[model samples]
Target: MKDLIFDNFQNAVDESLLRHKSILDIITKLQESEGRINRAVAKSVTNCGCIRVDAKKQELPKEDDDIEQLSNALKTHIEGKLCDSCREVIEHEIGNNLFYLTSLCNALDLNLYDIFIKEYDKINTLGRYTLR
Candidate 1:
């Protein structure tokens, strides 16, 4: 019975990992497309009565290192047991990030609302409870 329970637990973990991997793949594609879309919008906006505003892009110390660093930081925070203040900060930051993403999608002519609804539907179909 112990072995059976362990196998079931392992299977659940594997399934969750696969789902995460699939989501990552989708996000990667979206990120790649964002660059192209941004360039195209930059070109087209000049004649479309839209103001072309250029903001200075911030450069990181190490390019493409943010994800790993963030993952490590989050792991450390979780392992160390996050304080209420830290949790609040994290939650706020997540909201900020989501807002930024939605703004970017709008600027890029992407239907963020539709995309969000589709993803939400997928999650809803997975037998998870969501606040209405």
Candidate 2:
């Protein structure tokens, strides 16, 4: 057996670290943007009592099995309530964000859940509070 070593190994590791940091920065920006979007959506839906009425009509299941069905129904109702332009804009922004996120994950050989956990830990360590 022969021992083989690459001269640029340090450079490769440093580059990977840089990429990881960049990904983290992107995640932070995305988190902030998501908070803003959520606030705006909540404000917009405040006056629309129909969502509450519909939600109240449904008999929410106690078991976890029907959670997905309930989630889909709520999402559909919210989308229906959004104006066409608002819906299109929201969908487009989400699609673009996901595209970049997946691409970064692929390049870094990481999954979204892992990245989210890492970011969450970082935030907690920094004494920041996260909603989730």
Specify the highest-lDDT model's number: 2
Whose TM-score is greatest here?
A: 2
Name the runs in model 2 displaced over 4 angstroms.
1-21, 46-80, 110-132
lDDT of 1 by residue, 1-132 (tens): 654553454344344443224445545545655565554444333433233444454333455565545434332111223345444544655544444454445435566556766777877785333322
Q: Which stretches of candidate 1 lie over 4 Å from their true place?
A: 1-81, 125-132
lDDT of 2 by residue, 53-74 (tens): 2234545545665546655444
Q: What is the C-alpha local distance difference test score of each model?
A: 0.47, 0.51
The predictions' CA RMSDs to the true structure, in order, are: 19.3, 12.3
